[model samples]
Target: MYFVYDIGGTFIKFALMENNGNIKMKDKFPTTAKSAEELVAQMVEKFLPYKKAVKGIAVSCPGVVDSEKGVIYQGGSLLFMHEKNLAEMLARECHVPVVLQNDAKSAALAELWLGVAKDVHSATILTLGSGVGGGIIMDGKLQSGYHLMAGEVSYMESDFDTEKLRGEFFGRTGSAVELIKRIATKKNLTDKKDGEQVFALIAHGDEEANAIFNDYIYGLAVQILNIQYLIDPEIIAIGGGISAQPIVVERLNEAVAQIKAANPFHAAKPNIVTCRFQNDANLYGALYNFFIQFADEVI
Candidate 1:
């Protein structure tokens, strides 16, 4: 058995999983740890009970990860995670070897192994959440650039300006969180995070809602198109809580079509698709990463 964990800003999901990707036991709780030590302590407390039964642990977390060296360079909202070697930190407490991988890269590996990209040599996956996080794969292998930031699509600039900090990055604009927040603020909805209500409005073809939705889709489509031109992957999978809406992919295709029509000098547009594993992808990916990292000891 193996212990797999997918750490998010708001929650940390952990599972006791078999080598074959079958989850034996799983659970999650709010991520209230304010610092790296607290985060380690929190995981130790939860994992201690099952420590004796597991071979090792694998973790998937946000930001630029030094997978080989087990260091987290930039941890999105987990501000205290910078410069911390979580794998080393956890191993010291649990006495079990631990491997760390960037969350998006882990998700991509899972897809390549058994999910949507299994049959494709080249693919890209974008997880639209608190901020857009994703990974790129080519030649049947995960590609972490020289800087270890290849799949960091969130930092891609949507609009640039010389005057200001130019914070209009895809990570912010292309995020589902921003989409909902924009709609909620414009519609004056009581709860800004009510995505169900927001999607309901879009589903019913509310003109005001559709107006904002169109802009969001346009931005997202353009970004996808940019990626399409860059890598020209066989397919681009969209995964996240908002992706469950079903309309997102459909609308994205429509917008992509519009862009192709306007550009006229068209190339093959991206073959966009939905991700097979949504929320649970990280857990499976983490397990796969662990297996790859500790191949000698694992079955």
Candidate 2:
């Protein structure tokens, strides 16, 4: 058995998995802890009962992770996670070996192992939610780049100098949160409107909402095109909470088509697809990563 965790800014999801990839038990709770130590204590308490049964713990978190060393160089939305070796921190408390994997990379590994990219040798996963995160696979292996920042697509510049002053990068411009926020602000809706509320307006034939939705999809498509031109992966899988909406992939494809028609000189476009595993991807991916990291031991 193995203990698996997918740590996010708002929540920390953990599960116990059997060797055959079946989840024995799983649960999650809101993340109220502020620092690494507090988070480690929470995990230790949750994982204590299974300490005698599990072989090790696997963690998937948001950051530029030093997978080999089990350290995080930078944390994305979780500001307090920077420069923390969470694996070591957790291991010391639980008295079990722990492996850390970047959340985006872990999700990509899950796709490669069991989801949409199963048959492909080269693929990329773009997780589009509050922020855009990415994972890349080339030659049937995860590519972490020299600095382990290879698939950090959130920082990609979408409009270049136009929004630099506003810190509006691809993550902000191509995210569901940004779309909803923009629509809410433009349409004079109540403050703190979410994606569901904004999309409801679009569904009801609100012109302003439709316009924002179209522009958001356009930005995502262009970013996908840029990713294609750079890596040219076999397929680009879009994941995250917003990707659950059935129309996202369809609308993005339409936008890609429009761009292709406008820029006839650019002959190549990416093959885009949606992830099969939505919210649970990180958990499964963390398990897959654990297996890969300890293949010899497990086998």
Best by TM-score: 1
> In terms of lDDT, which candidate is strongest?
1
Question: In candidate 2, what are the lDDT values of residues 24-128, reduced to their tens digit?
Answer: 899998888888888888989999988999889999998899988899877876768899989889888888889999998998988987899889979999988
Candidate 2 clashes between residue pairs 3 or more apart in a chain or in different chains: none
Q: 295 in model 1: Cα distance from truth in Å? A: 3.1
Candidate 1's displacement at residue 176, Å, is 0.2
TM-score of 1: 0.96
- Native-referenced Cα lDDT, model 2: 0.86
Q: For residues 198-220, write the lDDT of model 1, one tens digit per residue.
A: 99999998888899999988999
C-alpha local distance difference test of each model: 0.89, 0.86
Off by over 4 Å in 2: 162-167, 185-193, 297-299
Instruction: Give candidate 1 regions above 4 Å deviation.
Output: 165-167, 296-299
State the lDDT at 204 in candidate 1: 93
